[model samples]
Target chain A: MTRSGLRGLRAAALTGTLVLASGAFAAENPIKLGVLEDQSGDFAAATIGKVHAIQLAAEEINKAGGIMGRPLELVTYDTQSDNTRYQEFMRRVLQRDKVDVVFAGFSSASREAYRPIVDQFNGFAFYNNQYEGGVCDGHMVVTGAVPEQQFSTLIPYMMQTYGKKVYTLAADYNFGQISAEWVRKIVKENGGEMAGEEFIPLGVSQFSQSIQNIQKAKPDFVVTLLVGTAQASYYEQAASANVNLPMASSVNVGQGYEHKRFKPPSLKDMYVTTNYIEEIDTPKSKEFLAKFKAKFPNEPYVNQEAENSYLALYLYKQMVERAKSTNRDEIRKVIAMGDVCMEAPEGKVCIDPKSQHMSHTIYLAKVGADHSISFPKVWEDIKPYWLGEAGCDLTKKDPMAQYTPSNPPPKP
Target chain B: MDIATLAFSALYQFGDAFAFLVLSACGLAVIFGMMGVINLAHGEFIMCGAYVTAATVHAGLPLPLGILCGTLASAFVGVLVELLVIRHLYERPLDTIVATWGLSLIATQGTLILVGSTMAGVGTPFGSFQVGAYSYSIYRIVLFVAALAVLAALYALFNWTRFGVLARATIQVPHMAAALGVDTRLIYSLTFACGAGLAGLAGGLYAPTMTLVPTMGATFIMEAFVTVVIGGADVFLGTAPAGGILAIVKSGMTSWQGQLFGQIGLLIAVIIVVRVLPKGISGFVLRERT
Candidate 1:
């Protein structure tokens, strides 16, 4: 053999040994987690904050010593608020990226779209957004506060504060329709009667007729389940027509951040139930807001979904630590074992083993002038009751099905 | 609520609804009816006016001046759009639709880029007063009066002015008007600018009552297109009756049933109008063309 050939062989053998040595070094490599969120479409305003919050959590987790000994590497895809994109990204995260866990989904519709993919691939999905509730999937864990946890406090309070007669106005969709049904049930339970109920279509901005009808109905308060920036117009229209009935919603202040979007007095006196708000006086919240604002100075606002997302990662990290493995089955077992907990910005939150939903502390917040929020009261460790009522037992995992309001008094 | 109060409430709703319908549709009527160009960017024009008004008002300009600036900005943008795109595609109405749709997309995306998704709006100007058990908005009443004023002003512009006559004549017989010492291009441009200005004015007036966003145009476009189509080719007369009829049907059904039924009622009214009078209300109301 030539002298140069012998030297080349030695170099190749040395590199191979180094590669093997590094491969044996367990903590040298990183574990991948997926973040699929709507970054630039209709849901962007609400979901973008969630993306940042999760990213912030990942950074903090790495700084505080990541899961086991490996640093968590986030593989993100912006779903652009498209359902098809959500399904595509969900599949991609599982099959292509092979991420250990996925923290994603914004709207309930998008969650429904990609949830089956997680099951198909045997992947773990952590959904971190407040929704209409009643999702009982085994492969997914929801960290956001659900409607049952919110409306249980909000409805009775509004009914007691305002008169016995209530008017319900909601967007014509699953979230709106289902929540409105809950309002009706709660209203009846509280000895309050619904004077009138109406569901406005998702994109309908012209509310002259609806406003006029609201005036004629003369309800003591209007419970709005309206969603989206467009539906936020109801506040302006209602205020313009001087249909000055008090208003309350579970979906408003937290998701849309309407208090910030709307001018003062428009959202004044409006009540909401949410997981977290900037106005929260808790030390955890203040510290979190300070950190988040420091990291993302130009961020418009951090919402409930964002806070839930930040906590979701820690919850997943807890499960992973308990399981001592990134294996999906092990993590699933740990999650289903229940009692997964995190000291969240909103307060202490835990996973309901039976339903796989968050037992979150919900605050009944009122919008003050200048878009300040005041917590009139807080409902501690509120559990998701709607799913249990719908026969969802996550521990069994025999069958998973979504529950929606079945018997709504026809669309108005 | 008492019967008198209910009746008055219904009347106010009808008037307010009519004004909104007319304000959104009138610009389209002028553009589509006169030029036979389907200006798909009409709503974006209105959005531009709204954004300008919002910026000015927030910048400490008086409300009236802000509105004027908004209207003028819309007009200027309208003239620019006409000069750049519509001028070349004058005779091709279908092409105008496609081109203007592209323009609409550009305008929407541009606005989204410039101003984020949501823009805060001004507080509603006037307060409320009780009408029996129900309180009514004075601003809505003002909206009704604004609509009437708009109609009257449009009437004066179209019927009494030399520019309006020449413009109408040019659109009716472009070759003849060109031969008779009229600049048809200028007339067309001016007419298009006027339509855009009307849309801007409507947008500025209504901006205070809405949460301003780049996509705000989408909400107005469908109603504007429907109302304009239902009004037929006559700008003023056709649109007024169509707005009144649709508004009455919508508001009445809404009061009796709900918002869904009200919208359905409006659609039903339009279908009935289209089925009976293929050329719209103007075709029926005026047997002889202007």
Candidate 2:
């Protein structure tokens, strides 16, 4: 059969089912949610957890009779960590499958690739991953911690507690570059000095010379924005070289869950700022974790990305119920109205009316000697400040643009 | 930094980077230079070694024994690959490339299914010592010595042993050596095993400083192929000199600028060498007297 003919047949069958369901079930059809996740590729390690967490949320929601008297049907497609696949599947989800909402994208690159399709089709997407953020799109709701939310609290605490001189190592990419700029801004804001900084390519794992360079600079602490499994070599190499300058990262720990992946003492004394870790002892987190564990008993520990997915689904549910409809336009209007909040496993999280991003709590934690993470202090309700700095009022919907630091700090 | 400290640091950096390039490329150079077959699964062979070493160590073996086990395991797999797939494609370069590339994909995905995407690696042995104002890893120094030792061992074996002589003669003149009662095919398999064993050793040694992932081989494969091509067909002399020059240039550039520029320097160095000396550094070094 011809490809378009097959699609036509599927489309006709889908409409027929919708008509029958609407006629028999209170004139309401099932609300379809699209899930595009990286299940078996480079981003799989971090994103697979999010996929499971979303599934758990959908299962729980359905058990409670769903929203608006319609069962939630999740249509999932594994992107296989390919950006081209993301674009293809996004088009199908937004146009052919016609899902009301999309909970997708793991990396910043993938998110950018799919964003235009969502805009062109007037589809709503919820990006549920922490990143170096400055996205202000009316059609998308970003539920991840931006650099300002993560670093504004982390840098000061690190500099004051550790020392005033910092050495920064970042992956030579947009996320790392922007996050490194934020490090400089936050360091300067807190009266700290950048002793040295260097950007390594993403796949260069040899760190011997880099370590020697760090040792010579003699920084109070080393701040890293390195990404990927290759960059994780820094932890072991640094430990072996005894360049023990009390390291921390704006990236790492929770994202890859490196603490669990690497042996102890390598990550000991390292600090990372995150929204959630499985070790949070709060009653709300404990209950949610227990429920998650009960559902998937053998699954590895949950990280912030998984918790973000779990939280974003509930927020989507809340908005859908609040609008009393699953229509994309109506749901988008309800989101623009703002004031929707959820008591997430981390803390109380709400949508910032101006930026269309999440305002949530951030925690500063240390990787313990036993490879478990523990929070030393919690910064409550940090808003996404970069969008506000750029005057990105998404409710006004002036521009669907990303804001980045224009004047990056000069190298030390 | 003081001049003395600076010079010592530069030398140490050179040694570390030189050892890295030499270790990663030596195995592939041997296989390609000696056997005349392009082993596209060279990286997968290294991955196999690393995974086996990590898995063995995790299963409660001593670190040294685990490393040895990794080498032996990779050698066994190499022999199996030879008997099954590689033998049929001998002297057929393009076919060998395709077959070996298919083998690499199968190895990677199969391991991903059976083992996992990521596995914990053993801790780096030894610690660090202060060098002037800077500190250097002792394991990196160990790596430097190990690379030179492997090169010298290969040289001595090829020059002094009866098996090495027979293997060299077989590669140089298969028909003549076979007519003279040498088991030419067996020599080929043995040489291939030796190359794979070297790769296994490199991977086992490097496992401690890496995150053991199924796709970790891709990180090492590019530099390996580059060094081998720039080294030409003379396995010992070519591989060593080319790898050293590339490593020194890369390490110096990394210290002067950053890792990005350092990698760019290495690639530019390779292009310049390939363009200027088509026979590679060894061919140039081993030129006949006029």
Candidate 3:
């Protein structure tokens, strides 16, 4: 070989080694946490706080020397509250951004839209919104309170405080339908008769007839599973129409913070069961709120979903630290060990290793006439029992399918 | 419940449904029905009205005054939209649909950017009155009366006024009306503005009963479009009758079955009406009279 050619070859070899060394160095860099949230559109009002909460969690983690000396970096994308956007953005964050972990989805539709994409990429995700439960995916961790945690506490209290006859107004969708089934099951189990039930389509704002029907039924209390901006108006319409029956809901005052949005007496005499609301007056929650407000002062209310999102990141950090690695399989094994828990703003929240859902401390909140929230009851350490009973054990099986009450597990 | 109470309940339901249908459709009746312009952004115009009303009310204005401001604000926006966008698309019906749809998207997103996602809602006023087992919103009754008053006002303005004749002439035969010294352009702009104002009025009226959001306008668009299509081209002859029949079908189905069946029945009714009378209720009534 010529002398010049040999020098060129030597330089190329040095360049290759430098590139490999830099690549190896990059692995020890900040861990990328993908946050795909509905920053705009209909669900934005409800889910925007979640993005803030995640940011706050990341800031705190980075301040405390992020998971094993690697700083936490957020790769955020606004899904615009559209399912198609959720899919598109989920793919973008998972593939192009090469994020280590993704925390995405507000609605069940949004979650289901991108869930398959997450599975296809063999990526890990966290869905931290309250839903109808029964999602048995090994690739995902759901920190939200499920039907077993919410309805189990809410229904009996409602039935006992009011009467046995209950009227249910649910949104017309998978979440609503499945949640309604849980309500029916719980109501029946508590020996309460359902006076009436109606599934309202998402955009049906007119509730005069529904109110009139409820009055005619004369139920002791009303159970509302209404979701979204339009369905939320039922409170105003019902209040205006003087449908004086007390209302019990698992979704309303907690997720949307409707008590803060609506005028007084609209949400009056309403009972809501949730894991967290800004009204939660615990020392830890107060400290969390103080930090949150100090960070994002313009935020109206710290909703239940935000707390879930905030804690999920800390939970992820804990899992990553315990596993001592960022590998998806190692983290999954750590999660399956059933010991991952966090001192969340909502209290002691633990990951149920078998179901991959959170065990929450559910609070029964009542809305006063002035729209003030009061927690009259608390159910501590409510396990997501429904999925466990439905035979969801992520360690033994990876169904990658959601189970509903009607669709039970196949025979062993 | 006794038969008397049941009868009152049925009547109340029908009235409420009728009021909702009529109010939702009234503005679209003028814009789409009379003007032959397919305004897909009709809902956003309503949103403007609601937003203005809610914002103004929260700013400590009286409710009625706030509603007036809302109506005027929407009307002014309508005029701007007409001058800038709608004027050019007057001869192009299909293009207007696309343009207005684009405008709706812009308006919804723009509102979101400006005011954020939502504002605190205005409380429904007028309290309630009990009939038997059911207590009804007096505000609902007020809405029913307001719907009638709006329809009656529209009927009078278009039928008994000089501007109404000129508007009809301009829309029906624009060149002829222009040649005969009527300002066809002015008539068109004014009529469009009126339609938008009426839509704003609907928004203002219903703002108190709804949770206000940028997308809240969509909740009204379906009913509005349905009512306008069924009402046909003649606002005076078609809108009220169409609203009445639809109200009966919707309320009756809702009362008998539930909301889902009620919606299904409404769609079915729309299908039957369109299939049987392609020109709509007004067209049929006009044909029979002629």
Candidate with maximal lDDT: 3
What is the TM-score of candidate 1? 0.90
What DockQ does each candidate score versus the true complex, computed on alpha carbons? Answer: 0.52, 0.71, 0.75
- Per model, the share of native interface contacts recovered reads 0.65, 0.77, 0.78
Model 1 residue A175 CA deviation in Å: 0.7
Docking class of 2: medium
Q: Write the per-residue lDDT of candidate 3 for residues B148-209, one digit (tens) a residue.
A: 99989988998899999899999999999999999988998999999999999999999999
Residue-wise lDDT of candidate 3 within A1-412, one digit each (tens)? 9999999999999999999999878765889999999987778889989999999999989888888989999999989888999899889998999999999998898999999999999999999999999999999999999998889888898888889998999999889999999999999989989998989987799999989888878899999999888889999989988887899998998888888889998999999999999889999989989999999998888999999999999899889988999898899899878889878888898899888999999999999999987889998999998888878888899889988988976657
Tell how far residue A397 is off in model 1, in angstroms: 2.1
Superposed Cα deviation of residue B230, candidate 2 (Å): 0.3
lDDT of 2 by residue, B114-213 (tens): 7765787688988889978777789999999989998899888888899889988998899999999999889988888888888888888899888887
Q: Which residue ranges in model 1 land beyond 4 Å of their true spot?
A: A1-36, A40-42, A62-103, A116-123, A324-327, A404-412, B288-290
The candidate scoring highest on TM-score is 3
Off by over 4 Å in 3: A1-29
Instruction: Residues A1-412, candidate 2: write the lDDT tens digits.
Output: 9999999999999999999888887735788999999876556667778888999999999888887778888999989778899999999998899999999998777898999899899888999988888877788888989888888888888888989999999988777888888898889888889999999887778898788778878899999888877888899898888877777876688788788778777888888888887888899899989989999885666888899999998998899899887776676677677788889999999998777799988989798777777788898999887776666776665366667766422222
Q: Report the candidate with higher DockQ, 2 versus 3.
A: 3
| TM-score on B-chain, cand. 3 | 0.99
For every candidate, C-alpha RMSD to the true structure in Å = 4.5, 5.9, 4.5
Model 2: per-residue Cα lDDT at residue B157: 84
Superposed on the true interface residues, model 2 gives a C-alpha RMSD in angstroms of 1.3
